[model samples]
Target: MESQQSAGSNMDNGYVSGDNEAQMLSSGAKRGGWITFFFVSATLTGLMIAGWGWLTNLIVYLIEEFNVESIDATQIANVVNGSINMIPIIGAVLADSFLGSFHVVSISSGFSLLGMVLLTLTATLSSLRPQQCETGSSFCHGPSKLQSASLYAGITMASIGLGVVRFTLATLGANQFDNPKDQGIFFNWFFFTFYAACVISSLVIVYVQDSISWGLGFGLCAAANFIGLIIFLLGNRFYRHDKPQGSPFTSLARVIVAAVQKRNILLPSESKDYYHEQDGTSKTVATTPKRSFRFLNRAALKTEGDIHSDGSIAKSRRICTVQQVEDLKTLIRIFPVWASTVFLATPIAIQTNMTVLQALAMDRHLGPNFKIPAGSIVVVVLISTAIFIALLDRFLFPTWQKLTGRSITPLQRIGIGHVFNIMSMAISALVESRRLKIAHDHHLQEQQGAIVPMLSLWLFPQLVIVGIGEAFHFPGNVSLYYQEFPVSMKSTATAMISIVVGIAFYVSTALVDLIRNVTRWLPADINDGRLDNLYWTFVVLGLLNFGYYLVCAKLYKYQNPEEEVER
Candidate 1:
């Protein structure tokens, strides 16, 4: 039976009911539960991700120590990203079938922590087994064959651990709140908590690397995961658990079976045997050519519901139940919007790739005694942005929501933030172009031994804009994704967000390869000795992203939870 509404049941943004979701914010049981859940989840997951950045840096440093070619760094990066990318799909399936969010997250975090610990050993172990040098020969590297093999193995484990937990934690966090309508608030908190965790990791992790041992850096990451696990365990009673409704494969199979029984598709007797479910378990799950065709035909008919004016259906048979079919139809309709996510995501991807790369290219000279490390500025900017966003969300956003009347949903904020992101990139591109010209002029003057005075620090504006963009865009986009996707597919929803980044990364890789193969423009695009071509490329992409945002703003629809208005 459907539950009756109490006061505060109709939340503005549509995910949470007023009383039910309000309790999520206030009731000690619910509030403490979700707060503990999200805080630890965010911190742990952020550390896991940040650890990769730390690992990449360490690998580069290790290459220098070992006198190995830098080109080999690509191999390490591939393993990390590939492992990370695969985890969500695997974990999502697990969550949908055997394990729930908690188990998957806990298990994944354990693997992640163990991987980092092993990675830490990579450096220390290699240092202990530093290769012996011959008399006046080529430079010798550290690490034995066994030690190198162990390092690769550890990296894969760690990458997988990091990959799986993100999907688990996010979906789990969203689950803490019972009512669907309150998810808007949940999503806002979700993104903010995520960024907050990132802020802490970016700042603290840097200090760990700069001031401490490499092992300690990874150990810190492991410690964060351990803490997150402890937090979840301690507060498990407060949270609600949606037990896995059996495997999605089984569910889909049941759907197929039901459809076939209703004469929705033509299939041989053998085709029906596979989908036959005994309780929640299946004897065989085949993906044969004939079975595939039957599945498609049934799916097509099921989605195109036959409803008459009198609400009587005139069909040979119902392939799937109305509810199940509707869910599938919803997924199909949202496919185009999901496709647009890649476009919005391109600029975001630039944050780590082109922007981080550019940060390294900036002037490193920091007066006589001080030295600013490559990409340290980004850490500063991100931390600052997090602080600002916290203040904005806490003090400013609520007031805007109250005033706007039409609820300042995460989607709305995300759509609006693209403007700032585009402007940020445009400014960065223009500044980069000028900086290059200045550096060139200075270089020509210096050929005559004339000290062409220092190039004034003009990159600050671009950095500031980028920081502001990061604050607005990343959180908003994340929240928007969660808000739109169905609850049952929350893991898949978060995975969709991750996939956008994955596509962007692959796209960037492709573009770089294309440029390398086709053009000598790379050198020309650099300012002084710094890389700016890709930065400009990202800037144009950001503007194109703004157009995508406008399109999304128009096409997007919200799922309203307040049914009382119709009453």
Candidate 2:
């Protein structure tokens, strides 16, 4: 019966056989399809705008509003960015193991709204913040304990809310599609919309925050979060909710446990010796375990007292199905590739935080009348990424396929990203060298907070290069994980990239602290320090990491080589 349903689901083009059709019929329309795309995309746009609004300018906010030191503010921003990326794994686990994505997203959005409201209050009520300092004042008052607590609380809630919603929403949207090609397209658009929304927030909301009023800016963010939540709830009926399977981690743990318990026992010699499943009907399960991880095969070896009369496992902890063991093996096989992304992301993280600090000290005047917001400088990267994603998906990818007689593999895309990332770092080093020369020539090195004569546009080339790299890697990582991971871990798989980013940010933070303590390259007054040397360090690291990635990519054997070839 299970096999029949699985076959039927495939025949129906990925929709589960009975429940989906019944749900569609009962609603008098299809429940999950392109119809839900608009609602999801719109909600994503609103939420992303809300998230980026406060986040992009966070370092400046902490410094100017709360009287935090510049380096301290940057560290705080790094931790906040790390937290926002790190918390998604928890949300993904909850979505995959207990609550569905809809519930997780809805509840998280409400938390985000509450957080934004808190932030707005802190900005509006003078009592909630430190006393205002005079421009160029030698002495500045820091936030009181109570004020500090309030600020941190708001940041914590907002971070949790935004973090949880980011990739879980991606998984939710991807679940609407059945075909792999459609899912790939959705990932592309998902990132495109994400970066585009960030660009808007960086330009519009960051400007409002920097130029107008932080209170008004935060209020706007709160409103956007509210609207996004409402829109998501309105489309509830149209969304196809994947029921939570009890903790996948538990099954994975069982595989390890069973393997250890049966380690003394000899490996199975025949397919009949291994337990497939209770039904013994899944064609997808291999008859024999692969040779790569033969030690784990002991977990599937069916000894006495392993099975009951009804074909159910009598001792599940002591023995698992071959499918479970294989699932664990798949994760093991992909571990190296996943590890490579961490190094790839760390340089980008460092560059992201450092760029803002550089911008604050650079000449930002656009024309005679207006000065660009320091935080908004990152918009160059976002805009570049958005444009490149569209071009890659619609033009470059297809053209490559036509010319090469095969589609561009995800690993290949990631490799391209690595090359571009290295180039971006080298360019950053050269640009910083020029900026430092200008600062020295103008005799501005001794003056703290003095803007150098260098134009901020000089930073755009490196940022644009990094953005182009992101265009290749971000979706490539998502597509690779989604396609390669076990079916039970789909949400978790999409969130893997978040893990990479989260760990990268944390690592970047540590690296920055180490540099500040050990060397004079990243002084609070960067004009007096060797900022170019720091970028040179990143370039070397990027080159070494890229070489490591090449090795991993070379060794990795895709689980579905046939499917890869077909693509």
Candidate 3:
């Protein structure tokens, strides 16, 4: 008879031996320091994300040449962000269940490379056909619909490929360090390196966007992505690949079928653990357990803390509901925390959109002699903010955590981030209020010309505060969702972080539109043409977000599910 491993035991009976079980995780750790490996991997991946931040800055400059309004650009951004995030859910499911992370990462990287190649072609060739686009634009206007469609198609493919790899790689990189004792510091380095990548990309890509041609900027982004893929591929020899565990969907189906047979319950009264049957090497379900209504604990009926006989506790068997089994297939238990994450992301989206508007409205000294390319400033500010945050996290947060009784949990950081984000928006509102006063005094039709040049400098504090908020929120949210969720649903946890951004985009868009509509009801001079009112809306949003943070802080608590204790 084959000996089976006892349930809940960490021992490696499923594997051939103890050494073989060690192969399951950190196989490469034997050859190198786990911390060094994770830090290196995290830095490489961080550079990839930084490239994206730079590209986000570059795209606005590109769109301006097209003369597209802020609304259309925002819509395109939201669509791209949402579609990429949603598609990754499928990619993660596949990686966790069937293809394995190695296959998923490799194939996804290939698709990313292909997409980048096509994007470069689109950028370089569009300038060749000026007649096809609108007036004042270098490219064609009407007849290039087919070309536009092709570019969008390429973007879709690239988004899916890069996005899937981004989701998988971070977790894979974290896996490089098997020592849970240092996992926090490992992840801190991971977050730091990722932001460092953004910092480097911001500095370099800004030059490509402004000093070089538009074609060159897109081309450079494509090249950077390819470089990222190459680095990942070359480093594969230093990595461990987890074997596929089978499809979550297939497991869910089996659970449902078994639940039906067991009279609609998970882990029937007599069944305390899961089991599988195998004739060859394939996995199949054994006979379902029968249900029995034997109370394991009657503490609810007893007053105070009266205890039952310890032997009686062993006699009574506990049964799990079908809902609990379904939950096992997903990371849905983290949904409450995920819901709070959306609030955090809303400010991030606003920083990109509303912050840009505020910057543009500020006084400018362009005066024909000096011109500030919107692209350069945005990249520099964002990269600087990310770098500063990394430094604080590395040097500051830990020290503070040690001094205080409580370590900075994800929820606490997120709550604290909202405070800074709210202040940033409030600062914007104050800047706009001053700008409006100057406009009204001059009786100018447009404040762009009348507003003081120093107003742009005022927005700097807002950007820096926003950056400070990003430090606390973005990576904290990532590490939090990943650590809290069940191991089986790790990839889903990554995607959940993205979903927060996706939802926040639409929410911010709707709020902006609603505020504009509501303000339109006032006289033209009082509302329609008044940009100052727009800042007020952001101010309101900031205040509401702050209040929301307070509620979340109150509700949020961490628990170690495996240990069954409050952390």
Candidate 4:
């Protein structure tokens, strides 16, 4: 009876016990340290500062130092950004499927450090970069093949490092906590630290690069990367490392194959006809598959030859359990909501790059002493995002819960983000309209590279609004994916957002190129082009995407509804 009782609990929850559970539990003084958060956060902060230090100023660096053309610089930046966001999927795959988060992060940080060092060398060694190209030069000198190779090698390494660090760091930090509330708190602080790092990099690091020396700026990044890597290594003992269970993706694929193979065979309705396993030794879940996605249920069907002489599942590599089949169904059901986020992210990606271009053309003065760096302007979005994240996490959520007697769901948070994003794009359109009007008044349409009398501050409201939109959507999408995704693919859940952003950026590049070719809306000289039209296009896209999101959200059923809560 004692064994039966224990087995019964196992059959239902499937929660692993013994050392797996023990390793995760927060113990006494020796185990979890508040200082652990400080060390890891510090490490991550250092890496973030190092990363953005160079990246934010990449456009300027390419044009000034590498002597690349403006359109070419923009294309390179988009591709680099896309690559940075895109490869996190590979990192997440490594984390969830094989190497685990800690090892991958450590290895990637090393790569980041090396990249930073290389970039520092590139900045210091004049031969590694092209001669300074004046803005009005008839023919600007481009980077030589050797210089280009060296430059690209460094960029590639840094991008790889950033891809690994992005979501894997979140997964690592969250692993430190067992309680859901603690996990939430960690996420809040995690993103805050991330944004805070970006803010400092934008203001301080970017200022140094623009106003001071690029060599010094690049060297500082190298130093930060070194310190961060060292600190992360030092705190290795304190981390509650989660081990990777062999790839869930492979198992999911196997289920599809098995189901297809068994498609002609009718799915068994009888409870006993399905394989119910408590350690594969006892029954659970009534041995019946859920009715939804019934085609997949065939994978879980038990046949006479499938079991061994002692009732064990023989050669089980080709077959799947009912839970596995259901897990696949959950992914299938959630895919529409997942797909919707790609379009949701597309406008933001385009706007981010375009806003930088807009800043370059506007008067960027704060009093007589200082000129605001063009790269730093987008930090407005980061600042707004950081502020709203704190407000939503600290105040808004609790208040909403108290008034409603229930927390807001991720879906609801995402829905709110869609509205704010639309508002942001509309505001962007209006601001661009004003800037274009000023250009027309000054008769500067034909003047290539003309700085309109319009204050760069005019661009602030749109950025801030988008920042607010990001504050909602970024966390909402991450939280939703983390909650809805299977346990084995938790790292991948975070990476899914990166995946969308990556694809969106690529899409944005295509759109930008298409616009340049087909419409007069985006020419080499943005001052002469109709950027307002582009923003309006995004507004229309946002509305359509929002509508699609609602339909998907309405139709979807949560696999584990109880776990998804706002608070």
Candidate 5:
């Protein structure tokens, strides 16, 4: 009787049948249990701790072990950061279009674990790294091309895995539940897990790296990655796997092609004239085309050769559904706001890369027993963001909703983030100005690699402000894109932020290079250079970006305003 019921259910998803039916259903029925969360979350937490352990302190590793210059190290770190975030778009595409999330994630995790092992070897084996350079020396023995390749190979492999899992996990985890409310809760919890894991990575892993040996620190990372991958594999029996439906990007492309091909054709006044969306071949009758973007409605206009004897498209070449046209229009409409994120992200990226260098050149001691590692300073931003998110979710948004009888919209939240981002840059400029003044008073310019008298903690306020800004914008941007984008493009929507961060980091790198070539503001030794001027430049750029964002935000309208609320 159980096997019979399982067979009936199997017809719905159409996975397997006959002899394997009972076996498959036994596991498949357990997919959505609360117990599955432990396996998935544990895997996620372990992977994050491992990845962040190495990634968070990348600059320090490059500068100290690889003998890279401070400015050069920051550039390298920025590139790595960009690559890690950028790779997720590819993972999301693969998950949504080709191989399902489980396969891609599992394969990616294997690569990640392998990379961690290789990186640990680099730390453990002296041959993998260049000799450390003496401080204040005019020269540095940077890693040889061969040695660099090995180190980078590991970093690249790890980054590829990290990137693939970043956005895909959310979708995979959400699939375990059918309830929309449960999905929302999962998304929030997922983000919280990442933040919490990074905090652990920063405090514990960074401490080990700084206070102990690099090999030991990376060895821990390798162990965690291995454990995470194992846990994920073990949970395979409890996963609800989605079948790949080919890339939705292709459908979007079809809409454009169809619309352009039929541009000269006139749209009929009757809604009955258009071909509404048809799922598979159930022939559930087409609905009327939406009135919006009526010009694109030509794409779905049923001509003589559009339908076959069985009600399928006879020529499946350039025709699209009304839904596809509308989806394309949704993408088109949200593009300006999406484009604005690149500029919005640029200043933040610039600050993050440079601030580590600043901390390295400032007093990093809180007391005789407690000294903060320069690289670990970035974690302050992460900590601040986590705290702010918790507060906003628990109290701030709820209070605001109670007072106004309406929750803050994604755009409105993003607007607030823009304000904070601009303010953060301005504050950074002021802090840098003070650091410069102190550097001058102490005549640290003569000392090539001297630390300024000012405390590195001065950098914290700007980072905290930036964190608050991210708390506003990051979720706002993510939720906005997720809710606004068509169902077919949901995974791609989540991956858009990665695209923004990747592009912004690269742009920040270019801006740094340009600044270095054009002016005396930035030098190999920042003590001899005008670091404050660079911060001021970021402030100006941020202000302009904020203005652009405001313009875009004002013009944008929510596609599903009723469905979204500040949970």
Candidate 6:
């Protein structure tokens, strides 16, 4: 009867222990599977379209509307990008610790709607923005303090809404599946949908913003945000909601505190000397803590007065379970792998911002009448990434596995991504060098805002390369973290990728500032500056970072080797 009840409990929770694949399959279909996937994907599409509509054209908006300097506009864009990525960690913590994913996502969507409305208002009201500079005029007025404050307030609210919802929604979607394979498939499709929505926004909404009207463009984003929130709420019945566990960080902290307090205690040679929790009771086990980070093992040491008469720990701060100690140790072990990705992301962040600036100075004419929007140029990357993710998941990975008799591991995928990134940087430098040559030949260097006699098509190859690289590493990083992190931190695990991207964008901002201050490589006018040299410098950095990643990957050991093999 207890066994039947346990099986029923597992069904309710959408997870089954052991080899109950048949039961999981049926229950998963009812709870999550393809039914919930459609709703989640639709919600993601609407939200992402709203997000990309404002974000893609921000640098141009800053320069044209506010009269901010070109470099300063890029810096501000970088900061905004960084903030958008960084804020997700906070949302993830909130989701995993207190408010559940559905609540967080719903609240964030409202914030997004409010933000987009304010942006639309700013675009509509001339008083909210400075006067547009006349053609061929040297003097341009900057935005007033009121204008800046209103703009920033809108940006802040929108960023919080967008960033918070980004990965929390992904987590919510993944929670529907009981099978790891389904979860993996969901992640791939989630990113594919994400990039596809961005591509649409870049082409359609961005065109509206540039060619039609900014007010209308922003109003559309607000509408999309509202629609997305409604769709998400509507799907609440089908969604499998996970209850928020207490903050996992507290357990991590307890491990450190307990270890420090027991610093003077002698190391135990027997497994019985350490405390282990089993079925909410202290139990003796044959398994001793691993030798690595031996000091942390002391946290689980059975000390006098550490336990109560009922076998529970009297003070959690002074004694943690072995599992708690191991969880902290897992994070420590993965730190180097995570650190390496930060450098990897920094170059990509720099490239994303730089590409927009590059497009502005190049000939963006497609045929005769339709000129490509400078901000929309990065859509090439999104389109490429989305296409390749579909191909890789549908064909490439399957073929590779069949031929090799093993699946492509996440580390291997990341390594391949590194190689492609390096190639992209080199290609970017070469392309920039040719563009500079064309600019010099035409003597366009002396003129500010001069378009180089070079086609914007030249930029596509490098962007496409970087996009392919992203298709590998972005999903790989998310998969790795999700698989390896403590079960209690599943939401935080997914958000770790966002944290990496956030730090990289901030680093990219600092790196750009450093370059501007130290070298003449990046000036306001790209035609007059050595933009090729900056790309070359990134190439060198990429090679060095790749080497560091290789070392880290080699040294790293998987916590669940069997699971990796199954993948």
How accurate locally, in lDDT, is each candidate? 0.53, 0.87, 0.54, 0.81, 0.80, 0.86
Cα error, candidate 6, residue 329 (Å): 1.1
Give candidate 5 regions above 4 Å deviation. Answer: 1-30, 33-35, 279-287, 565-567
Clashes of each: 11, 0, 8, 0, 0, 0
Candidate scoring better on lDDT of 1 and 3: 3
TM-scores of the models, in the order given? 0.73, 0.96, 0.75, 0.93, 0.92, 0.94
Weakest 10 consecutive residues, lDDT, candidate 3? 1-10
Q: Which regions of candidate 6 fall more than 4 Å away from where they truly are?
A: 1-8, 12-30, 134-137, 278-286
lDDT of 1 by residue, 180-296 (tens): 545445555555565556556655665565556656766676677667656656655544444565554444455555556556445444433232222322222433223223443
lDDT of 5 by residue, 1-567 (tens): 111223345434533322243344553454443566788889898999999999989988988888888888889988988888899899888887878778988999988988889999899998999887785466877788889899999999999888888778766776565444455556666676778788889888988999999989999998998898899899887666655667888877877777787888988777677766454332324666667777777788878887776667765555777777778888988998988888788888888878888998999999988889887898888888888888887799889989999877888888898888888888988998888889989999888889999999899999999989888888777777777777655567778888899999998899889999999988988888887788778778777877888898888777776566534
- Which residues of candidate 4, in runs, are more than 4 Å off? 1-35, 278-287, 310-312
User: Model 3: per-residue lDDT, tens digit, 1-567?
Assistant: 011112112222222111224333334233223633643464355336534643455346434544444445555666676566566676778777777665777787777667767766765675522233332343434325666665676677678775677667665655443344355555566656665666566556655665676567667766766666667666665554445555545544444444444452322333223332221233434423322222211111112222234312121122223222433433433555677667566656755664555454455344766545544444444555567666766677768757985466767777777777777767766766676566556665342223344445566666777777777777677777766654555566666677677787777666656655776512222212555565566567667766765675575545343321212
| Winner of 1 and 6 under TM-score | 6
Candidate order by decreasing TM-score: 2, 6, 4, 5, 3, 1
By TM-score, the best candidate is: 2
lDDT of 3: 0.54
TM value for model 6: 0.94
Model 1 misplaced stretches (Cα beyond 4 Å): 1-35, 38-86, 127-148, 180-182, 249-318, 365-368, 442-460, 523-530, 561-567
Q: Which regions of candidate 3 deviate over 4 angstroms?
A: 1-54, 58-62, 127-143, 249-333, 361-371, 439-455, 513-535, 538-557, 561-567
Q: Is candidate 2 or candidate 3 better by TM-score?
A: 2
After TM-score superposition, the amount by which residue 231's alpha carbon in candidate 6 deviates from its true location, in angstroms, is 0.6
- Put down candidate 4 lDDT per residue, 1-567, tens digits, no spaces: 111124223323332221134232233333332556987799889999999899988988887888776777888898998899999989998988788878989999999888888898899998998888677477878889999988999999988997789799887776555555666667777888888898988999989988999999988998888898889888876665556777788878878987887888987678777766633664556758889889888777876577777767774654677777777888888889988988888888888878888888999999999999888988998899989999998999889889989978778888888899999999999999999999999988889889999999988998899888888888888877877777778789888889988988898888889988989998777888899999999899889999999999999876766565534
Instruction: Report lDDT (Cα) of residue 140, candidate 3.
Output: 35
Q: RMSD, each candidate, Å?
A: 8.9, 2.3, 8.1, 3.9, 3.9, 3.7
